[model samples]
Target chain A: MSRSQQLYEAMILDHNKKPRNFSVMDPHTHSSHGKNPLCGDDFYVYISCNDTEIEAISFIGQGCAISKSSGSMMTEMLKGLPIQEALELKESFLEMVSTDISPEKKKSLGKLKVFEGVKDFPARVKCAALVWRALEDALGAKSGETSTE
Target chain B: MLNPNIRKQFPVLKHIENGHELVYLDNTATTHKPLRVIERMTKFYTHQNATVHRGVYGLSQSATDYCEEARKKVQTFIKAKHEEEIIFVKGTTEAINLVAESFGRFHLKKGQEILITEMEHHANIVPWQQLCIKHGCTLQVAPIKDNGELNLEAWKAGINKNTGLVAFTHVSNALGTTNPVQEMCDFAKAAGVAVLIDGAQAMSHIEVDVQALNCDFYAFSAHKMHGPTGIGVLYGKHELLKIMPPYQTGGDMIDVVTFEKTTFAVPPARFEPGTPAIAEIIGLGETIDFLTEIGLNNIFHHEHTLLNYANIKLKEIKGLRIIGEAKEKNAIVSFVLDDIHPHDAGTILDTEGIAVRVGHHCAQPLMKRLEVPATIRASFSMYNTLEEVDKLVAGIKKIQGIML
Candidate 1:
């Protein structure tokens, strides 16, 4: 497959076109806005946590296909995971896009591996990590806009 | 008619990218340097590398001569009255900041206004904003029409007794709207207001006569005009430059520094603080020679024709909405494809070796005005061909087919 094909993977395309849980979560326990200053991709992530587990996750924003799909996939992946596990996953995903991860750690990422092509394209790494950065901020003590510079 | 031979002068055009010939349409961002510019810079470093304005050595004198000669070229290029009025800075941003710091601090007072247009780049907007916040001055913005044209009537109305300065772009980087600079400057002058024109996007595509426009100050970059980066010019009137204090204090800007008292230099030396980008300035002089030899009129006509061709060709593609359809637009064409984000479109275009700019274009206020999150911009130069425009259209079609 070509570099573009690898970038716009079938699963990524499907998620972008018909995003799951792609809406605002009202009365959410945690929420934060994310912005990719380089490309002007703005997004807001919402999560409802119950006993440290994310009972619900949703996002509402406007961005490129990679960002929207990553947000959609993030919401789907973090729905039932505990807040700690979700934060760990966010760390793993950031590492995967920024640097090389071990095979065992990569396998643990599951469907998130579709973003492995992101490391090849330095410009698109921010697109894939927009929502994850928002999640990281929303999960932390601080809650505001997070910029992926 | 753009000379096809012009493409051969740019050595980068000979290379291939992504298994396809390069189609560089980001001229509005920064133009590709010609072999003349590159060779001049290389020659300067190899033969004439010396610190200017302190050394008595022959090489130092030659380097200083080259630097001063570049300033003269710039003064003639922009039709400034004196070479001392041209201050070499980092780029357009630094130029504007210098004006905002030196001129703004001297002129602006509490409750006064610095009027600007809604279509200004962040460079033209933010420095004034900083001045406003610091001095309790008001930063007023004139609105743009829906078609991306500057509302001239509104701009005139915004100029009041308390309006201290009027800053605007000669050509819109994002929308490609050429503002009525002469008329605006005349009106502002009638109001006893100073006008600063941001000529970053205008210098390459059009012939700029600062004296004719009667703007108090003008700022532009060299990289956008097929010159080397890290060099630009800020042309201020001699009378204005003589009064405003130095923007930065350092070795060169001072005439005599004593323990008890310090005296500053005059005009250009007062403005240039540190060791300048000597080689880049020499390169800029060479680029000016290259452009002047071809004639700016010929280059302007060539780019205008290419823009018209690209406008017609890109419009043929379905679901592609061309943004900023100003009546007086030049070479910039910014648009959006239906349901396909600009980043995706840019990626697809890149695969076909077509380079374009995709974002708010450092004019977020204009983006909000246009009601687009971002746009894909393909700006042309004299070296670009209509065939490259066809490739852009074809690339957009391929992106639509694959993504949508």
Candidate 2:
């Protein structure tokens, strides 16, 4: 019973209903479309950055609560952060949510630790990781397969 | 309500997963096997494991008999004219690809059009699309009404002179809309156009008579009808199959091998190349027996009852809306709750040991027509209980309370 928690938590649903920075990013430096063709979960991640810091980060798309909330919380987390640290954090977040990690390792996630619950839900890990995968694409860290500009 | 006696036959129905009774509502996708079907398959592998039509030994003869008997069962089940009309393929997809290539190459020309409905599963749509691309033929879609019913007038008009062939599903897997196959077949027949029906979703839920429908080709999967995977039937008219070239070549389908070229076997055998799924074919025979014993009419009535009960209950939920409310539908129900995505609802329901399919269900065009990205589908089967529908209603409420 403890393995599964309220996945559509109040926070996730609120974020879904009123997502932050959920609009087309004008004059963006990088953008990528995150799509789960299987379930029809689609989102776009946009980033504007200087040499060291991300000046702006936003997203726009339709998906389940996990996907939309991931985008909403993600834009809030990475905005105005150092580019290198943000990329590293994105990597850690993806790994933590997709696979099992110790509770001690889970603590490193801070507020995003609730998302680690997705590890218990194998099918939903993709929903939580979709925006980050797009972020990884926008960061120029990975080659985007279905990227839109 | 399902007969308890019938429910007990399916061992998986009594299964306790995550400490909750399993509520299976994704029967359209595939059904759980009964004890009889499972045992029949086991018996084939344990004793009658041998090649067909080329055996000197006694064991091989018995194996051949079972496989041949399975083919006869299929022929009788669909009411096809002869055993030669039933060609075994991997599944419905392969069955359709055979006709798209074999029949398309022989009959279709550059300007000819292949008519299909918008509600068809990808299996029925893609093969024809490939055939059209290869043959430079046009692939046309007959539109479905907002309520998921096919527009009869449009369908009638679509059978113009240029239309060489028509194909559609017996039932919409995504919407649960049972298309009037006999009436549609009549239109195609009137135009002297060839016709094919994808029966993957309909075989378990309804009684299919290919002769009555008079379709040139009918495709269905064994797994959908409590049989094993990797085996299905393509029911083609004897005259058409006899003239049509083999879809695949080599091995069992060959008459003789020579350096220059090889001759192909007659109908059924001509299309079935290489070693077939023997155990699966035999299991399909047992599945026919199982269905025959329970009767298709009984199964159809039971599922329709469940569908009605579910429809009334699901409509009571304020935000929930059933996607397809076709005047004539059975077994399956697709719905969306508030603004909640189907996947989120699926996850919540899975925790309650309820199995419901949530996706575009391989019918994206229908989703576009319905104006929904995806839907939560609860398809019923004979073994499903009334209480299970109540659990589903409760699960929908829980999703509303949590997410809305």
Candidate 3:
């Protein structure tokens, strides 16, 4: 596939159209804001933790399809995983999107492999990782702002 | 009105993108450089590359002459009285900052005012804002009408005895509103307020006669006019520039050096502190000559036709709402589609090899006033054909089909 087609795939567009886990968790245990100031993309990732496992994960914000779809997919994949596991997932996702991770590691990313196309387009890397960055910050900190600049 | 010959001069126009012909409509951001400009720059670097003004050798003299000749070309193009009135800076942002620091801080006292329009780019607004914060002065913004036209009465009402300077854009970069700069300058002059016209968007699109406008300062960039980037011109009245202190003190700008204190050079040299963009300036001069040969009147006429064609074509698309509809606008058309954010639309447009700009366009306040986060802007140039406008329209329709 061409770079543009890979970046804006059919599944990604569907995810953008009807994003899953896109809401504000009222009694959220952890939440953090992610913003890309240059592109004016802003999102707030919310998570409810039960012990170490994630009871729920969701996001609410405005951005391009790449970011919105990635956010939707991120929340979909991270739920039911331990906070540490989610953090580990974030590291692998960032690595895979930015570099040539081995096929074994790429298989580990699962549905998040859709974002591997971002590696070819440098500018869209921030768009794809904004949600993951927010997820990492939400898992790591009590509450703060995470910016992909 | 579209000149096929003119379009042929720009080599980039011949290329295709994404299995489709490239439809470049983002002229306001920066124009595609003509072969003349590119060739001139290449020739300068290949043959006559040297540091200007300081070299006593023959090569240095030639480079200095090239730079000065470019300045003279600019002076003639803008119809400034003297070549020395033109000072070289990085771009419009640096030009405004230079005035804000040197003239603004030096002249305006505490509790005084610097007035600007709501339609100005961030470049024209921020420098004065910084000045206002540092000097305990006030920054006033004249509001734009709902139609995106500058409210002349409101702008005039903002000016008073306390208003030290009036800084406004000749043509708004966001909305293509061609401001009544001559009238505003006259009113400001009557009020004893100095006027500075930000001509970043105007110089390429229209004939800029600084003498006829009679403004204290005029500033624009070279890249926006098909010249190379990192070079700009700031044309200030000699009388005012002489009295205003040097913006930056450095090696080339010093008249005399002593342990006690160093004296500064006069006017243009005083303002230009260090090494300037010599090759880019020469390229700018060539670009100016190329445009002059085409005639600004002919270019304006061609672009007007393109704007009208694009405006009608874009309006035909359902759910598309144009942002600015000023009666006297240039070739910019900013619009938003229903439910689809500009970024999404821009992405879809790119698939069809159509280029446009989508953002707040560095006019966040104007965006706030317009009640939208951002808009899709398709700005035209002289070389843009009516066929390109059709491509843009078709691209938007495809975006609507996908997103809406």
Candidate 4:
């Protein structure tokens, strides 16, 4: 098998078995629903936030392994970050998933760089981006707005 | 059976990927068009393309004649009672929506019910759901048997005096199960309910006779049947179409425009508003001619043979489960590997130059009932062969070997 396929399998298995932050948040300050109508992948992410930090984060819904794992990883990354920092992380994350960022810049992406492999499979990119898009929507980005870059 | 050389007609079959021959199995989504259909549309745009039904010149007359001739061909292809009963639209989705807006809005009442089967595509389900919601009616779905066949007993029990309409697909796109549309239509007729059969999946592989089936409405898209996109046909019973109100309001459908009021044209022209898909419709007519020349019965039999060959070969693999096993089915085979996700299977097959569809297939409710997230679907067209089925089996084995 190819390296891309091996990485994808590992990603999917990890997502299915030990999904990160798979729970509900109390006193949720931020919540958003994301749906991929084409594949019927739907999920909601809840983030409990204070002025300077994210107290807790959780996700609830069903999707493919790529989506679920991506959401899990995102929740872990967002916890303890300030609201502004989390928002900036979202931008860097989007840049990492979509091509056009330099290799040196991408090296700074950390664990989120696991999704760089998704660029080869265009259809699966939506799976990885679903949760991130939901986070943007929760932050007041209008519906139907897509960040293709 | 179609000639083996028929594979050469579709240019996309020769498409090479990763230094391997492309084995396309996604026909249920859309069939690759034959070069004849492409050439017909090209000739129309290049030599004789013009606006239809308005100008007095020769080119305008030719365009109008071509458009109307396509309508006549559609009427004959589906065996509609009259040429006037066939209304050209944008595709199957638009056709169903037109029926819901015009017919459902005009006739359906508060206490009435719209009966549908569980195997319907979303295009068949959503429009009626919207109509029922808008008109204060109930939408009831008939159950499917474990083998993916519609529960005829449940269908009979669902139909009552309060049932206003019955809409369903003639073939399940995901399962490939062929529903007994004629029998269902007869039952609906006995209950005084109108019947609409979504022929999007069936139109390509099977011969459709709207008059023989006695369905109130039959909808299909041209692209599914080796024709150009943006063109479809909706065949309605003349009496029902005459009674239903116009769907869209625009020029060409009106007979006279006075300051006080306007008079509309007949049934088909009333339903068809704005400039129609002229070149595409003309290409659909040529596609119909091509199918007729080759014969639809030959295509149906050829696909059945291929389906049988695929079923027998696929059953040999251990830990593989075919989703739907209806006895009366067309050329689609949806299945799941015990441990592999459908996306993984599709990716592996795609790497081997075999294209298959993997997802809910626009039937989320059915997916829920079947108790699976998704299934890998390999649908066949008339041009496919037993060798391609062998390739699919080989691909499945390769996927299993890797995953297990």
Q: Candidate 1 residues B1-404, lDDT tens each? A: 86698899999998798999999999999999999899999998997799999668999999999999999999999999999999999999999999999999987778999999999999999999999999899999999999999999999999999999999999999989999888998999988999999999998789999999989999999999999999999999999999999999988999899999889999999999999999999999998999899999999899989989988888888899989889998799999999999999899888889999999999999998889989999999989998998898888888987899
lDDT of 3 at B193: 92
Q: Is candidate 1 or candidate 3 better by DockQ?
A: 1
| Candidate 4, superposed: residue stretches over 4 Å from native | A1-34, A43-61, A75-87, A134-149, B400-404
Model 1 spans with C-alpha error above 4 angstroms: none
> What is the per-residue lDDT of model 3 for residues B255-321, given as tens digits with 9 covering 90 to 100?
9999999999987899888888888989999999999999999889999999998888888889999
Tell me how each candidate scores on DockQ against the true complex: 0.78, 0.70, 0.40, 0.29
Interface RMSD of each: 1.0, 1.7, 2.4, 2.7
Residue B116 CA displacement from its true place in model 2, Å? 0.5
Model 3 / residue A61 / CA error / Å: 1.9
Taken over the whole model, the C-alpha lDDT of each candidate is 0.92, 0.88, 0.89, 0.86
- Candidate 2 lDDT over B293-335, as tens digits, reads 8899989889888999999999998999888889989789999
**Candidate 3 segments whose C-alpha is farther than 4 A from its true place:** A1-6
Tell me how large the interface RMSD of candidate 4 is: 2.7
Residue range with the least summed lDDT across 10 consecutive positions in model 4 chain A: A140-149
TM-score of chain B of each: 0.99, 0.98, 0.98, 0.98
User: Highest DockQ: which candidate?
Assistant: 1
**CAPRI-style quality class for the chain A–B interface of candidate 1:** medium
* TM-scores for every predicted model: 0.97, 0.97, 0.95, 0.90
Better of 2 and 4 by TM-score: 2
